[model samples]
Target: MHLSLVTSVLLTFAVFWNQIEYQQLIGSWQLTHFEGMEKIVNSSQYQNASAAEKAGMDARINYRLENTVYQFEEGDLLKFTDLENQTVVQKEAKIEIKEGNMLLIHEERGDRLAKIVEFSDDKMVLQPISKNSVSGKLIFERIKK
Candidate 1:
């Protein structure tokens, strides 16, 4: 009986670890990397594009990925910075986590960015589920002030 109780406790901790990870996100996180993204952006077609088109793509990519930061606060308040140190993407958002530790940003908008592939106190990685396209990944690391 004692052994069974101990086992149950350990199992509980394992499940709750994801919740603890979410708590750790109540701070600033900077975009660090995106898994499989380089393959898409640096593909032959992208490289063969005209210089002007390349510049346009570069601008969109930078705004979405490079130097982008997110601040998550208590009560599900979130601030997104599409371009670092510039205009704010959104001043507020209500976030939530559904089954499988899916991070739902702007819940009211019905945006489902599912299956946070990996999460830790210092790092977070997310990959959105898509039916047609191969959705890439997003990685963020906690930014210390």
Candidate 2:
């Protein structure tokens, strides 16, 4: 009986803790910078690539850094928007925070998960949780509270 009661208490505490962390994410954030792109760009593969291929890669990365906005709304709703073109990249997406640090975005295409490397009042850093992710840590700044 004592062990069961202790487990229940811990579970409740964990859920409560996660809720607090999720609350902080309820706002509009813009992607300002990212790491690891340089590593990929400097790699031998990128160096050997054709000029057109290199330009494509650079364009994609620039688009994301300058135009991506992730709005985390109430009820776990996430809206990914492209500010440059004023279009919604993904609508009706759901987000969940696990273990108070792992962020999972459930989209129609696939789930994108990231680890919260650092978070503050206006700045957040996310490290993509993927074996194939080479973008490294993404830095976001809160645009709307």
Candidate 3:
């Protein structure tokens, strides 16, 4: 009986601690850098692409890295806002944490899973694990209120 009680207490503490850790992610985060674009641009596929195709990819990456803000709100709400236009591009996203450290973002467009590579009070790095078009570490810094 004593061992069972100890186990239950430990489990409760673990769940509580996990909640506190996840709460750290609830805020606005600005994309500071993207590590995968360089690999994409330097790939042979990109090397042989037409000028227009290469330019388009470059434009898209620039838009994502420079103009995107990811907001993780309470109640599992997620938003992707464009900094340039000051508009929310995706307002219907829902967030979930699975496998302890994997962040699952569900959206109408698609569901994406990213491994939480590193997380702290003011910074986070996510390594994309889903089959998204983009592959690389997304580095973000918390936006101060």
**Candidate with maximal lDDT:** 2
Tens digit per residue, CA lDDT, model 2, 1-145: 9999999999999767544367888888999887867776999988999999999888877876777788888899988865436443546688988875889989787998988878888998998888785557989999964
Error of 1 at 86 (Å): 12
User: Which ranges of candidate 3 are over 4 A from the true structure?
Assistant: 1-20, 40-60, 82-88, 131-134
**TM-score of every prediction relative to native:** 0.67, 0.67, 0.65
lDDT of 3 by residue, 1-145 (tens): 9999999999988765654345778899999888877788889989999999999888777877777788888888888865436443556588888755788888776887888877889988888885547577989999999
Ranking by TM-score: 1, 2, 3
The alpha-carbon lDDT assigned to residue 66 of candidate 1 equals 61
Residue 11's lDDT in candidate 1: 87
Going through the candidates in order, what is the number of backbone clashes in each? 0, 0, 0
lDDT of 1 by residue, 6-110 (tens): 999998887776553456679998887775558757889778999898888777666666647889998877787654355545556778877667777774456
**C-alpha RMSD values across all candidates:** 4.6, 5.5, 5.7
Residue-pair clashes, model 1: 0
The per-residue C-alpha lDDT of model 2 at residue 65 equals 77
